[model samples]
Target: MARYDAIVVGAGFGGMGAAIQLDRLGLSDYVILEREADLGGTWHVNRYPGLAVDIASVTYSYSFEPNPYWSRLFAPGEELRRYAQHVAERYGLRRRMRFGTAVEQARWDADRRHWVVTTGSGELTARFLITATGFLSQPYTPPFPGIDGFTGRIVHTTAWPDDLDLTGQRVGVIGTGATAVQLVPELADVAAELTVFQRTPIWVVPKVDTPIPAAVQRLFAALPVTQRAARLANTAVLEAIMVAGVLEFTRAKVLNRGAGLLAKAHLRTSVRDPETRRALTPGYDFGCKRPTFSNRYFRVFNSAHVRLETGSIAEVTAGGIALADGSEVALDTLVLATGFDLWQANFPAITVRGRDGVDLGAWWRASRFQAYEGITVPRFPNFLSLNSPYSYSGLSYFTTVEAQMKHMGRLLGELARRGAATFEVTERANAEFLDRVTERLGTSVFYGGDCGSARSYYFDPHGEAALLRPTSTLNAHREAVRFPLDDYVYGGVPA
Candidate 1:
């Protein structure tokens, strides 16, 4: 029955950013509801072996607040958790956080001009609701037949147990995505027998991960600008690959081809056997799906104890797994490294009923997935979906967060100026934004490249790769700050 100015349905970086923006706008009476026992979102939830940021540590963090003391170029998962804690404490956000509270649904109440959010603990109302639940928050475990009958221990990477140990046990991993790539190597080192079931091969380039010396850390801490320069340099490289190579695929195809060749060369040198190498090599174009940087993933297959199985999974047996080719792999433990269910479980992580009882999930499924400026939507007054279509920009998630923060600032600033109780994007504006993004995507690899065989989660069930913004990071930033204010309709105040 409690009410506030706003309620953010996550505690991840995105939600943290939203809360920070709200505070800056003088709307500080907000609460952050987190499902887990702690903060850090993914960093708090995922604790599997070899968990680290794929993007370089220097660039992966917030441009405003840089962590100069990262142990390695790619900071470990623990470091990220610590960083999240540091940010929360620094921003005084801990007092506003409610842990162990999972939001079930949020509905707009037209009469009250507020949002009613239903959580496990109780219901709360707020003038505004921001769903910052990350895109990869939901873990997907493919329903292989007889999976329930499996007598052996079955675990998903997202829900990894703390006490569980794979040492000296026969283990089977059922994925080769980024998480699997990091985990398979660790499993091979301990598991007595290891079998990897890869449905689609992933494109991996060599990771230049090195330790940051103490002196370097001190220099970065003392000079701050030095870290900024390093971050800028790394951002440029990522932009070249994401913007130039992928987004501008038609004009800069050679760059994409060059990246593909580099991954191929890395694969060729890492694995000795031709057949194993071929099995590991991806057939799709580079940047069709998100790629990872790893020095150990391809080399792990060289171990005699590790076996790669590319056959279709028929079902899970009591002891192990059965392949469609009548082959069987017996194991003591089954690990489902399958990634997140984006379109189905995510997009709108929780049930959201907007104006006129329009369900967000059903509307996106029936039509195309979209959001105006990746924040607002038509018929969804005073709502901001941080993890929305065409929102993600560049390689680092911080880029996306900062851009959205700017968007929130502009929109809320206007609302305050107008003394409006509610603001909703017009349908015409939303359609125009969606159309512009879709047209621009025509030149991207998702539309022009051979992505059919890639099996990338980037493409939703409707076959629209609307996850990433087709524009450059700079452009996204510029547009966020300069979008037309008239696109949104403000109400609940005198003219």
Candidate 2:
């Protein structure tokens, strides 16, 4: 058994981020357990034809360690991989990473006030367990009747096999979510014919993407402060957009419709055929399910060879997909661009036994997965779930993660320094914390109060989601960065 001060699960941005923050605080006794061999989490896995980030490179990176080497305004998969590797090397994170070690379970031990963590290898004990298993880590594979019997190759966008070639073959992609928005364009040029099955139309913003000039890269590399300043300036602008989308934007769904007038112009501008352009147009508000920004996605439908079929998928046939409306589409290949099963797989394949041997998953399921500020759970001591709800939706995950991590770091450091054995939120404190989150979520557009007529995850699991921080970016920064520790009453075993 190897003893350690703390153990971080998953090597994604959140896990690596937590480890990096731990390093900055002069804490060395920790290890990062990664399920994969490489560092990049989602970027490492999803290598489909047209994969890139929706958030611009300006705000997608870390504030403390800015990468001066993004090839494009919106980075592709390759550039993102390089950036992650660069961060790992620069921060000395490579030596600390334990690859191919999947965490199976974690149990809280009341006697020692530590976590007994189980991985693929063996049991390891640590004072704390930080799970960075991202929201999109687990892919949701819907049951398709004849999926396995498909004569042609079948692949999910998340696990695209590099060997299979899409050239000249007829392809049918299921699900018109973020992944399909990118894939349709890339496959349109190669495949003889392509058809996209749209469960629902998603709002698409015109991505004003351009290659980064060499001179600009040199300028940022030479003057780091200027780059930081630019990031700050851009962050400030996006913050306003985040707030306006959540609350007081409009009285009815017409606000989003009127707001999409410019998007219509861009759609009409990129797509030539009036029918194709109208088919691509969305009747929903922006920011619903991570607003998609694309320049080529809209134009892909104008090629005359591609078609967007807005029908539900009934099942997969031996030859191809059968639509819910009794239509059969033939294809040589199928790609699942279906969105991830985030927030649903919050606890799976891992038995998290919290205080008194109570399972966190059962607790969350029974209580509807509510958390205290989306950070702390009521009974889980010295445990933190990274990038929890309400902390998301800003689009600038870098800023949001840093803010939350900073607050967690402060809590951890205070505990370590004071020799505190265990720390968990009290029942009253957890209730009050939820009050703030719910209040914040209510003010936002997600409560179905305004902005548009489209239903979004901002409402609930019943389509009435109650998530998102109500405060502005600056206010969120202040609260997350400089949160008061007094609200949390300290409790622990004797030193």
Top-scoring candidate (TM-score): 1
Residues 196-277 of candidate 2 have per-residue lDDT tens digits of 9876677777788899999999998999887888787877657656766544344434554454666777787888787666
List, residue by residue over 6-45, the lDDT tens digit for candidate 1.
9999999999999999999999999999999999999999
Root-mean-square deviation (CA) per prediction: 1.1, 2.4
TM-scores, one per candidate: 0.99, 0.93
* Candidate 2 TM-score over all chains jointly: 0.93
How many pairs of residues in model 2 come into backbone collision? 7
Worst 10 residues of 1 by lDDT: 486-495
lDDT of 2: 0.75
Clash list (residue pairs), candidate 2 = 246-444, 246-445, 253-453, 459-464, 459-465, 460-464, 460-465
Worst 10 residues of 2 by lDDT: 246-255
Residue 268 shift from truth in candidate 2, angstroms: 3.1
For lDDT, the strongest prediction is: 1
